[model samples]
Target: MRSYLSVWRLPSAPVLLVAGFAGRLPSAMVPLALLLMVQQRTGSYAVAGLAAATYGLAMAGMAPVLGRLADRRTPRPVLLAQAAGYPLLLALLVAAVLGGAPTAVVLAASAAAGAATPLVSGVVRALWSRVDPEVRGTAFALDATATELVFVAGPTLVAALTVLAGPAWALGVSGVLAVAGALGVATSAAMRRWVPVPDGPRTSPFATVLTPGLPRVLLSGAALMLGFGALEVAVPAFAEAAGAPGASGLLLALWALGSVAGGLWFGARVVSVSLPRQYRWLLLGVTIGLAPLTAASSPWVLGALLFLGGTAIAPTLTVQNSLVGSIAPAHATTEAFTWLSTMATGASAVGAALGGALIEGPAGVTGSLLLAVAGAAVAVLVTLVPGRRPTRGRAPEPVAA
Candidate 1:
């Protein structure tokens, strides 16, 4: 607790934490907001789904490019550009949706809005890496926990605003938060003065984002997210099937609560093991926790198991961030983190789609849980593959700044 408090005492950590939360709030809000806006205007869930998918695809495709821009120059200009453009683009989307514009036009505006979103995740994680090493693990833990909170809060906010004002207003609020958060971060002393340093002679500019050990890290992250998505869908399906559909939200909340507790406890501890070893163990823990869910016949039992499984969430993410710090070239840290986000997002989408199908198939929710376990197993396999390990006995390249 004192260690986390010490982190907040740093000059800009509190501000950055708030900015990160507000900036990322849209990540949880935007797709739903887009879906609501499109559905209200068009009265077609199909079109709304298409529009939302386009928005996600746009964001996923552009994140790496935007991260590269932030890396090559500075996050200031990148954030400034995004801050100025995103709200306008979102406003355009709102107008297009409300004004009965063509579906194509509305879709284009949504894509533009997605592309204009600030690179908050990459910038924030990269910033943490630049801070004190002693607290970096805790920082990552806090970040992961806060992100889970955002997932919980953002949807509630959107639902309330949508019911009160309308989906357009809800979307506008997302734009407002994004603009405010991006400006706060962009103008901060940490962002204004920070620079990425070169990784010396052997590092190629084009190859920076693809550092040797990073691909496996990214793959494992994707696999983990895949498992998460499956669990998400399975919980809802299981709850609805058990005739307690309303319990699904509470179950997911409990899951997040467990993750929060795990993050706090894990962050407060001192570690002696290597990050890779810790990650593998955490992966095993997550998988072991998930195994019991298959036997759960009631929502209450499933909820308890979900909470147990969720306990591994933040610890795994903390280790993953540490691994990225060690593996990514200094100059392209932001891009590398962005790639992680992109892979996870894409994989989660795939997992959700697959899980939805599997839950309706012959095996039902059990199959979905099995698939989630499979994803964790794949993550563990990726880590254990001998070829994935980086070479030892070589000194790490120094930052040139």
Candidate 2:
């Protein structure tokens, strides 16, 4: 609670939150806006889906590598470089689309956007972790809640903008927002001044992951996100297949809104429970929360069920992030945080593709949503059961890459 409290009380919190808002808004636009763009442009969902997949894979694959690079050196330079690079790539994407470019061209443009995405979430998490030990878990909760806030506000804006001016306006608006967010982040006193420990040479993010406690945290996060990410894609396609073509956006919105409410509710509190126990319970709750989604038959009913099922999101994410900071070596904290970020992104991409493929022939969205539940359940089972022996030690540091 103190960490959460101290964060806003910090002199820099105001400016940093603004930058966070700017950086996060694009996530919504990319999934929904790009889907609309590619679907409309090539007159095929398959091409659009592939294009989006390329973007996901590119971002997930490269982000950890970029974060590892940032950790050894100053984060400011990385932030500034991305500020310059991302906008230009986005501009190229807009141009390619308006010019009626081929699928490869559009796909390439999306990949460039992915490659250029700044590690805003990772940066923010690292900063929050350094704030105060008493408040670290709450801080993580606040951070996770903030992410949900982005989806809430960002998608609502995209929906309104896309409806009024089409996906082009949404894309253009996101590019401008990204620039504003990047500049805000790059120039922040905390960001400019923040540096990894080591005061020494840099190490690989993979090496950071190899650290005992970190690998476990990263693995847990990956397991949770894999399900959530896949559900995002499966929801829209499932809605269309379920005889409710117009319900996709609303259903997705309900899911995000549920997370928004749950995240805020969870973050605003302070608890003394051990981090591992917190994580275990959160995963168990997710397993229970999501169990009913497989049986939903209507969009309205599904929306209500999703809202209830979202209760696990904030708790699970907050605990995962808190553990990352709690267990990280001082010198490699930022890199360690970035690895967790990368895990979620990777899981999401894998989930989306897996969910999409599962829903293809006879499985449908019902089965796809069932897969989501199963993924979360698997995470819960892995943590509590033996034989998956954790490699961490009481006082061991992460293996240096």
Candidate 3:
């Protein structure tokens, strides 16, 4: 195996880890905060889903642009700009909610915020690749596990602040954390120790999106994310419909709990599996896992099933990241990764709205949850296509070795 662990031995690893954690804090905070904010202010679960969807859509639409800028321009400046602007945007959003500005306005702002998303995943992943190749997998695994942990805490943190101070305070705190995180990373010497790698022609990012294998990965990831968006919407609706809406948090926590477990399990395995095969199996498993949710009846049942069904979440994500690295050219890795994030974010936004609508209508929460299953299925289906599942890159050494 190549020396992926070399980055850890580098003098700069400590700073990178700190910065990565700081940057990741916002990932967990944003969705939960947005959902809680809209839920509280509008008192409509569907509207809350819409807000969360809007935020995701923005991240999808804008990630590539920001990432492209990072590749061609300076990552530090991009990071700095996002660090400064994101907080202001959140403040505006908070004000709009407080002033009871119409839902349309809130949605628009949410979309803008989403679009202006800083491409955090792209940035961080790019940072890791600069580490020695032998350690990249371990580094990726470690980061993915940490991110799963963030999801576990991010929502809880937002919920607590909302209960204690108000959702407004939660939003404010996330913005502050994001700004601080971005600035901290951008300023760190380790953050600037980036190695430039591009996978495509020096063309517009639009051209980059058109790259062959890249789009398939993006679409597959998008489909999986769409399923996630549906679950995000359905859990809240399901809880409310069951006469225990407040238990939605517990349900989601259970889901994240499963993810944390899965991430831990995957992290411990030193596998040499092919990235595409890993993806195919992971997607299939995730879809199969979600099948049980279509029959969920109560909060307790939903929580239990969600936790069980969530077992594949982190593994699928880990494989997806590995595939992205395998396929993209060295120079454009960041941009490519950003494109995946963008696509997923967009798909998630739309999926959430679709799920919300389904729950609000006759299909109800049961049908809405089926959307998650469908999402997993789509990812599996994509892989089943001829020539869609080949391992890219130099083909990662057997992940099982």
Instruction: State which candidate has the highest lDDT.
Output: 1
| C-alpha lDDT values of all predictions | 0.84, 0.74, 0.74
> If scored against the real structure, what TM-score would every candidate get?
0.94, 0.89, 0.85
lDDT of model number 2: 0.74
Top-scoring candidate (TM-score): 1
Per-residue lDDT of candidate 1, residues 106-187 (tens digit): 8899899888888988888888877777777888888888888888888888989999998888888999899888988888
Error of 2 at 189 (Å): 2.4
Give per-residue CA lDDT, model 3, range 160-257, as digits (tens): 89889987888777877777667766776655555444344556537665555666777888898888989998988878878888898888889988
| Backbone collisions counted per model | 0, 4, 27
Better model by lDDT, 1 or 2?
Answer: 1
Across 110-168, the per-residue lDDT of candidate 2 in tens digits comes to 89988888777777777776664655556667678778778778778877887899887
Q: How does residue 224 of candidate 3 score in lDDT?
A: 89
TM-score of model 1 (CA atoms): 0.94
Q: How far is candidate 3 from the true structure (C-alpha RMSD, Å)?
A: 4.3
Candidate 1, 31: how far from true, in Å?
Answer: 0.6
Candidate 3 deviant stretches above 4 angstroms: 1-10, 31-55, 99-112, 197-204, 387-401
lDDT of 3 at 101: 90
Question: Which 10 consecutive positions of candidate 1 have the poorest summed lDDT?
Answer: 392-401
